[model samples]
Target: MSSNDKLPQLAAALRFSVLAYAMAYGVSAHAASEAVELNTLSVQSSVIGTSEEKDVAKYPGNRTVLSQEQLKKTAATSIDGALQHVPGVKVQDETGTGVLPNVSVRGLSGSRSERAQFLMDGVPLTLAPYGHTGQSVFPATFNTLDRIDVVRGGAAVQYGPNNVGGVINLVTKPIPNQWETQISNRISAYEDSDNLMNNLYLRSGGWLSDDFGIQFSANTLNGDSYREHSDTDVTNFDIKADWLISDSQELQAFIQRYNSDMEMPGALSPTAYEADRQQSQRLNDDYEATATRWHVKYLQDLDWGNSAQLEVLTFGHHDTRNFVWGFNTAGGHWADPAQPSTDIRNSPREFNVYGVEPKLSMSFGSQDTLTQNLILGMRYVYEDVDYRLRQTNINTGAVTVPRDWGLKTDAVAAYVSDELGFMNGRLKVTPGVRFESIHMNFEDRNSGATDSNQINEVLPGITAAYNVTDEWVAYANAQKSLRAPQIAQVRGAGDEEGEVSWNYELGARFTKGQSSFNAALFQVDYKDQLQWQSATQTFANIGETRHQGIELSGRYATQNVPGLSLGLAYTYLDATSEAEGPNKGNELPYASKHQVSWDATYDFSGYLSTLSGFYYSDAYSDNANTVEEDATGATGKIPSYMVWNFNVSKELYQQNNTTLSVDFSVNNLLDEEYYFRGVDTSPVGRYPGLGRSYNVTANLTF
Candidate 1:
């Protein structure tokens, strides 16, 4: 049967399931007066938890948490820099300010982070989660985030569609219990350049009443990259509120606005890069974007002897992005050399998404013996997108519209998981399943052509964890993941079927007084995987690919060396295509084989110092695995690179209720020279990485 035939059945089943769950649990709200105890719902419900050490021990899969203290020690000016310390993750930097995030997990394509699921405060961060997953514009800044949670496996049952790679949650700061205000500023200077960048951050929050609290945060950055014509301006503002409606109910809400404009220094040819890597040839290339988002969550405790809770969350966002490019009319490369533009192309995209999710959690039995915790949830989302392209002549001042289209997507997902614990909670097992139904429609405004497609999938997963000793735990998980074809693919001539894969992982975590270690072995078998083609600026399916790897990370505080700590993370990946094509047995693009990172920190009295670095092995830039560079500098073998960083901070002043501190950091301490191919708009030239940069920051709190 066709997917369209199943749509009605799927919709009816979902509606029935939702209604049944509501009818079974809705009565608890009226009987709240007989609740055993009062418990306030945590705002960070979607994340693992704030206590990293304890949370990691009980989780059934590999997890990494970068705490606020760790983020401060790294002193990274961008989110990508901080993510380098994580295992099984790769970052391709296009802009030093992290205006656009290109991050991948477990050998997935890092071009625009299309394969991974990105979340901010448990809400989707992409322009359109179901229509266009590419992160053309990232709305959050590094300083505004309180922490980061990287879950590499066992997330398929809770998060769907594009979760084959994993889930990355950027957690924002919460409202404090007491009134407080903070102000911070950072200044950055690059090597061989006089341009300076400044970042300012302000935040204030506190409880207005015993049952109500609110927080406000704002961040602004104005800076220039290492190259000329690479200036960037970004602003982000957010306000959040939490209300304790009653002893058994609570509410949380937030609204955010973000805007950015940046000039893109287009790529350069090999010869041009050799001559001067920091020169801009495409003067008219730039990007601009804006986003407005709001979210609300309500939690209610049932009167079923404090064994159940219900949560309802709703969110919506509107995003607009525009890219302007200048090209030569003649038959030559756009960045061959600095020249006046003959034609200009403008592409703008707009997206609006609204979603609502409701979840119910119930517990049975006792923890001392055998206990089971069941979770049932469902989500419905609607997305609308507008895409347009226009061209203008530089000399004649003539304008023309070439392409204009609209896309609409309706997606629904339902999931259920039950965790059973035995041996006094020493051994735990969880089995879960998720059902997804998606419907998409596309319309070409110019041609008046329309098309529609539907996709339905059922994904299942199982995970187990065993506590061998008080300080050690072992875990394993296996799951099936899926991602629907994007809007472009649905509109184009490519296959409309969704990409599916099976993922498996085995890991263990150990912690002993001031020491911790984690290791995992993972593998993924894909029936079909989607890859970005830079030349065509579209996605194509690569059949039958396999990715297997191992990740290791550890931290230690040495007793011999007082006030000193060390950390290390490493990964070895083997990602290959087994399809019956010319690219068979070839290594996937941007899939680095070996990655390593290490860090050391010393804290004494009122001073703290840190040294850190990361290394990435070489990988191909195209599916053909071309060894030699082309004239356009598009396809070639990316060379290996290693970079180091150092940071130090000191407490300058402290009073009864106020404190001041200063810190300085030097990124790329050795001034490494590196370049990337097939990145962003500069798909045909070498895009140079940032050189050695220095930052000075001052923070004050009262």
Candidate 2:
């Protein structure tokens, strides 16, 4: 029993079988204190941060709320697998399809990715008719979310200047409250027992009176390649509607579609891709992607007496995406093998984007004793981009022309926030500010090159909270964030700029009855940032960087439990880079200086259910430790490992309602093999992780 004592005896026998199935599912103790007052109230935020409900008492920064039963027990299949359980987030994949997964949160990666800011249902999925650059490759699944509002550090006065490293709304799901219908299905590795994932889902909702409402959902999935010619097929659709023309007025609408097809595996040299993850190969090339989104919203509420209140909202979105990416350099052996030339690299690429965004919000209050609370907002955006690259003339393979290019942008914003309450409401204070502007362009349909640029920004925030009872809360915050550039960081040339950050936070929150806790300690200070030059495609900015941190989360429900539950999370990070060239003090490249996660679940007494989990991380760097590897060098860092996953589930039903479920998982399950991302100087090293995988999912409901 040496693998770390079999993972703490499998996490104490799954926490004593979920505390004996929550004491035989009688779940009492005042229904776990009314489920902790419905898990800290506050329903909708008018579509992402600041619609009202004072978004966590005035919203100043660092938010994280995932409900819908924590996104249906993380049975996620998109939207980056539901944000990988939030908490510094990280999801990487250069291949194996999953449409180019690589979404970093606190540590931001790639083109410096204008640091987070993804919203839907309040639009802002990078604005402009869903304009691309959420690091396109069409990766964002969770079928069509129901909840996921994670705002971490500097939201730049609530999403402005492309927020510098935080904010992801997604919300979706609502409209149910009556007439309902559902169906679900899942079957893995269909025949052969080894790799044939399948999934399906359908949903419906109702409410055609007293205000009107509607909802719809659809999903599909097909798989056979976690890796091996990397196969995949996915589809999704969603729709929502609502209208309430009384007590103030409201309107809403949303539509979404997503599609995927993958089969690319092009980098292999880190010891032959860790020997193809220890011989689990089928590498190939060629991929596909598609996306669509549409949205509309309108809201109004007014009353200007002592209970002063007024609001207005507007939104519109349309996004279309298409894709194809390359790689198959004759199975590796570069050193001028024409530098990755599987016949000059059979190419096929295309990227397109279109965008639009509109918004407005307002609020005020004053009655007597200490009024407290005020908010203001504004937004407008437009975008268009299309890029194509096609090459295949090695020995006349045809298709040698298409290398078009395009880009366009126009953005605007304004913001204001205030919320001060001296006690009575248990003290709270918040200050906010926002201002942004942008106009960027780049076109080159065959040497007819064009360029344009313009930028402006101002962001600010301040927060304070002191409840210290009635379920505790104590907070402090400071914010300022910005990110612009990116029309390819400003066009047909190079000069990169558009990154800035400044965030500070101190937090605590606790809820009694069924226990709950949250903690925060963040510090960010960055500027210019954006590096990746050292054998490069050119890019630099480095200069002063930091990301100190601490995050702790908790959950409990075993007070003589019912269906049992327990959750835990811990994070401690320390990123560096003090400018002055060559990565000042190193670090910061794939973060991870300690991370932990734990989970336990149980729901017996029929339908069976059991869950187990464990995750730990601590290791980093793939570059920016000031490069160096040979030349007697040796400096790439990267070595770090800690993985374990487990799952079990069961549910069956037929006779027409047809509900069926069966899940079994074991990822990395103590295999200890490592390297999930990060490898420099191509030679495709480090990419293992995925040994010991056995997932069998089967869900069917109607």
Candidate 3:
């Protein structure tokens, strides 16, 4: 009934569930006659095809899946935080409060964000109605996600493009048959801050003869400044309903709302280091963001004996963001002559997207003949962005006029893919093509011009796989992708062009009982790549850049030992840009050459039933052409470092269904002193990596 008493009940429930699942695992044979007895607590391979093991091997590109188990064991405070464990991914912090961090894959930058797609529950997270820009930010409070899928390479043609780097898909929790709730609380000693995170989820469906179902979830996260001025409070609510219209059809709808306000620590300089990590906090700077999303999806089994299915989905989102900040001098002093003025901005955006896809498959030869499958789809999206900016000069006490602008974009695309299975399904080949078009219109309320531009592209992909045996598979693929020019470029304010990317890859997967491994070697080529020159604060067209690398990943879980798991991944990248411009044939700015990640976990079968693990990452940079710092080394070369972590959960009360977990983590475990990027000639440093810190967390689930 009370907050203190809730966690124990949840812990009991989790204990009971884990006991039941473990019992089932022991009694039920892996070669059972019926299904594996799926339940909420059972972990399944979430890859595309069947089990997670097969899922890893079925892809022709590099991919990683962060299971709920893994998500719970790490300090995944944001989308970037959740993905930092994956190889080839680097999270950059432009703001201290985790509000505006930039996520980059391989060696790409933010300007080419369109090359990567972000998704929530299989839907594009883009505020761009057409879903072309492929950009979206998830709230740091979205810690309730079920899983996240990170796919690498241009293999994203299956989900639609701008996917040169691939796609990041965040899957929400599914409706469970019973009531559930959780509360996660954590405090920081250094910053003297605490966070209370809570979630309540409910599901009911079988009452209608298993034909209908409904689910709802509500979550809240409240916290104060972890440092001097970093603070955030956010809330989100989601609801979903499913109706089995008949044996051949189903209808589903979902809605979600998120709101939050976060403090802005602004950027810091090297001279501010004496203030210490926890004591150094900024003031009078903050940003607020809100979003509402809705979706409806319908699936129908074709009349042709359920050999085919048609799916139609519609999605919409409304988002608003506001930011306010002012310049501050060092040493907590405001009387500096060089300090700048205050700035304020508001951005509002709306997006609507819909699509329909039909797929058909035919079998032959009694599990031996060649099988054929085809998928046809069409999608349309539209979005509008409006922004207003106002500023004032604090030093001169001068007022600045307000400026407003709105940009509208529309997109349409059609695609078809065919899959052929030969040699008794041992050899699978898939070929797909997409034709897409985009149009952008920009209007400036106080400007003298309204500008518009249109562009079209045809892209193709081919993948082939050979099943060397039931436990092994080898595959190769080639894909093409393109990113449309930004709407600002159409206004003639910048020199920007559409970017085209080509990706070629070869990979293999091996599954041996409880152990699985997957690896991919790829070369990504870009033409007319976009790069920015900080000296002039302008954009330029770099002729070409290449990202070539090999990715290796493996996992092993043993039932014989019961509750022990191990996983490892490594990515080696040689990213370089060749251009006729000033920095020709130089290493692409900020692209790291090597990355590694490894984790090991063991669960004790005693009453405590403890789980513990560790993780590490190598060093990387923020610029492609390392020219900033020539004093120690090249300009963009960020020093490398590693970190470690541990977590444990125990069951307290079984009858009440309660579980409790305590986590201890150390980031930058070695106190690695390094900056992501900084100026060698000046005293100012940009984006210093957080120093070593320890965090203890407690979570109660029922």
Candidate 4:
């Protein structure tokens, strides 16, 4: 049967599920309200509990935490900008505003960040975590985040399937203990342009009583990018509530809404790029999206006296996205320099996802003896997606629908891990395993074609950490990871298998009075890796690939110059394919060999100033490793580039209950020219990068 015939049943099921969840939670809240109030204590509910320096030191792998202070010092307007400071992380700037993110870690493909797992407040951020891993529609805003935690290894047992690259968790702001209000605004403009961009943020929260608290935050952006005809508008709002039922029980919930619309300045041909890089060739290309999401978590402290705890989390979201672009018949791509077409094509997609997870943690034994900690968890997720494409004749004012399809996915996963401590708690080792079962079905409404697949896998991992001294630690880990075939791949003719990989890492960290350093060497052995075929617009299984890299980072404070701090991060990667194809033994596309970043900050009294620079080596745009530039500017070697930034901020007033501050920043201080190929939407031409820009911001708090 066609998916159109099952719409009513799906709608009914969704409504019933939402109603049941609300009713159950409503009763629990009422019961808690009648209980006696107790002293309130902060809770650690995220996957990485309480992302503090001390907590990170004990983890048996490489980890980095960007604190609130560091975020402020960077003065980054987008999450992509903030991540540039981390070693082994690559961010491709498709849009200057960072409305869409293309991030990669450890030389993995950065296309839509499909190789990495992204989480918001410990919940999956992609449209469908198992069915569709690509992040085509992202609703996160930098201003709403409190911090970012990145884990490079030792996370596969707890999170999967696309965790070969790493895990990135975005933590949001928490409710304040007392009443508070804040407002901030920033305006930015580019060089040699009159266009201006405006960003506004508002946050207000407070504790209504000892047991209940609520917070609300909103961020809006309206601006023009560095390129012509690239205007963007985005708005995000969220509300969070915390209910402290008792000293041992707590409930937290949040609801968020996001909407965005942006124009796509299509890529430029070689000749067009040389003429004017920032000019838009395709006028009718644009993107629009909207999303509504919510999540609820409950924590219970077990009475087993062994420091046992139980956590239950439930989350859901509905998202819709529409992409419209002009098709060039002469050039056989989206846009052509020789001939630009008026024929328009629109692809609209809608997705719905719901999930529930329950976890239990406990500890046994004492410090004098061998201590052990155990964790057991289970998760279930459901996803439904609808895709449609329509073509329009601009001259005739007529439209036709050519394609329509639907997909449904159901996945279940269970995991268990135990950590054993020896040598008076100085050495720790953890062993874990995870099992996943997934089923997917796809149906074409127009052609009456149907396809289905099922996948079952078991992943295992082990990690060890040793404390060499009071301020030094060494860690090593090995893990197996997997990525299921996407919905589109399943619908093709060939039978696709899930991609699998084995990852290894060795790292050490040191921290003393005024210095800290971290280093890690990592390698990945990937099997059945997928590669995109531009001619067929499908993916093929490429066998036997390897990625090896080393990351280094350090920070120090100089005693000679009070309040002066210096930081540096560097990465070197080698990625190659061993498949029996034409591209065998070739380096992966978009994977640069070297990357570096350095920053210096100085504080004088209450004033602060910072300067930073970033550089990346050249890379190829295709698996063939083409060196010469093609006519369309698609297949070529990208040129190396470097950029610098400067920021200064000062507090103008700080009194009893009010504070005021101002900041100014200049990005791309050197005004370097750079471009990228093989980007989404316009993969056949050169895409220009951001040029020199300046921003000024003012903030008020009470």
Provide the clashing-pair count of each candidate structure. 0, 26, 26, 0
Which residue window of length 10 is worst by lDDT in model 2?
A: 28-37
| Residue pairs clashing, model 1 | none
lDDT of 3 by residue, 98-200 (tens): 4455667787774324445676777777656242363433533445577888887535455665677777777777655455556665543332234322222
Q: In candidate 2, what are the lDDT values of residues 564-668, reduced to their tens digit?
A: 887777778787777786657777776776766666677776533434343536444544653433221123455555555556566655665456666666544
Better of 1 and 4 by lDDT: 1
Top model by lDDT, which number?
A: 1
Q: What residue pairs are clashing in model 4?
A: none
Please give, for residues 528-631, the per-residue lDDT of candidate 4 as tens digits.
77766778766788767889989998989878888798989999989888788898889988888899998899997868998987888998888899999978
lDDT of 1: 0.82
lDDT of each: 0.82, 0.55, 0.58, 0.81
lDDT of 3: 0.58
lDDT of 1 by residue, 478-525 (tens): 999998877777765444668899999999999887778999999999
lDDT of 1 at 519: 95
lDDT: the better of candidates 1 and 2: 1
| Sort by lDDT, top down from the best | 1, 4, 3, 2
Choose 2 or 3, whichever is better by lDDT. 3
Evaluation by TM-score, superior candidate among 2 and 3: 3
